[model samples]
Target: MAFASVPNGNNIRNEDKVNEFLQNKSKSMAKVYLYMGIGLLVTALVSLGVGALFAGLFSNFNRVDTAYIAENALVAYITTMVISFIVLLVDGVVIARRAYSSKRSLWVPYIIYAVTMGVFLSTFLIAGIDFYTIGEAFGISGLAFFAMALIGYKSKANLNVLGMVASGFLFCLLIGSLFWGIFYLISPTLVYIFDIVASFAIMAFIMVMVAVDTYNIKRILANGCEGNVVLYCAFIMYSDFIAVFIRILYLLSALKDK
Candidate 1:
């Protein structure tokens, strides 16, 4: 008599373990994204609040007293930007160096980073980027972030090389900026061309870094890191998103000027 083949019980158990791990992984990823969203919301609120405060310094939003503020406004604006930028740098260092000690330790620096970054980013308005263009750039940034993140999540190919690529681009941008200033002294037209190329390079760098960060997030969980590490991953994602938003906003402003 011929025997009927049946599924092995051990194989069935292994499949069940795989499914359970996938479910847990999904939940963990959701939590990390939730943290990212919260950080972004904090940044948005701080940005709008600081922007209004700055406008109020000029009198009121309904009727900005251009004449009243003309003389002192530039000085105050530059001062605020300078101060916030310093705080931002300090907070970034704290997050990178100390926040990894524990879950509780991360919150203060994370929130401070969000707030300072908001204050710093709002200075763009003082430089004349309008809310409408900001909104447009934000929408585009959201789309690009989601698409790149999805690609990173689905891709089986290792993206570790992207980190090196991003670093090389960053070094080039720094060197390019130094040349930009020097070339500007010689030719204003050359500076303008540098501005365009540098913008494109920065945008490219941000996209690659975003992919690397997203892939890193997956690796973090796969390697059995604790929950705090997941939140740290969220912080990394938040930075990537904000970086892309800034570059996109700048590009939009540049295009509008053109």
Candidate 2:
């Protein structure tokens, strides 16, 4: 989504004036990290709950053996995707409405959605997914997140052009991955290749997004377009962070299988 314009007209008439933009940009970035933390916490709690639920459901009968466990795990994973998509749709609508009506309040739904994602991630965590793999995923993703946010906040380079290009690549990557996963069944070999490629590309994209989004936030503030720019920045940060985290998880899990 494009940054909201100020009533005065142009967003950032002077992008070179770092002093004028620093304070607000810092605040906006801070808000983003806050939301990221909250989202992570909610995800952990919810995912553990989901795991406990599944474990309980499966423990009752010898008739339901490991095959049943495997089947249930697959079903649960699919269920998570559907739920996440639906929630994301709702989040988009909420964000749009807030953008028009009450922009500052947009963070509310965002936090809720973050919690929902926590639940989604927990699914894999609970299914006997390796803790080391999860830790590695978070480690790589966290570093990536900070690096991107830092570059976006500190760098003077116009990442906007790179952002657009990276976005296109990311979209294509997703489509290609889906097709490969479904058609070729994404064998372990294929999964590894895709995971490595996706991690590198996504890391690049996330860095670009951080720069572009940070620039946009500064522009919004510079233009005097108030009302929760913090929330908007937070949203962007959370999205980048989560994507990186998930991608890292995918890469690590594929490697673990080998």
Against the true structure, what is each candidate's TM-score?
0.84, 0.70
Where model 1 places Cα greater than 4 Å from the true spot, the runs are 1-5, 60-80, 98-100, 181-188
Which whole-number lDDT from 0 to 100 does residue 78 have in model 2?
75
Tens digits of per-residue lDDT for model 2 on 156-219?
A: 7776887889899999999887766554463667776776787788767766776687666655
lDDT of 1: 0.81
Pairs that collide in candidate 2 are 43-118, 47-122, 152-211
The global C-alpha lDDT for each of the candidates, from Candidate 1 onward, is 0.81, 0.70
- Candidate 1 per-residue lDDT over residues 1-258, each given as its tens digit: 999989899999999999988877788788778989989999988888877767666553345556556447556777878988898888777777753466356777788888888887777765667889999999999999988888788778888787797888789888879776689899999988887888888788888878878887887777655556777888889999999999999888878998
Once fitted onto the true fold, the runs of candidate 2 whose alpha carbons sit more than 4 angstroms away are 1-21, 61-84, 168-199, 223-227
Query: How many clashing residue pairs appear in each of the predictions shown?
Result: 0, 3
Instruction: Give lDDT: candidate 2, residue 167.
Output: 91
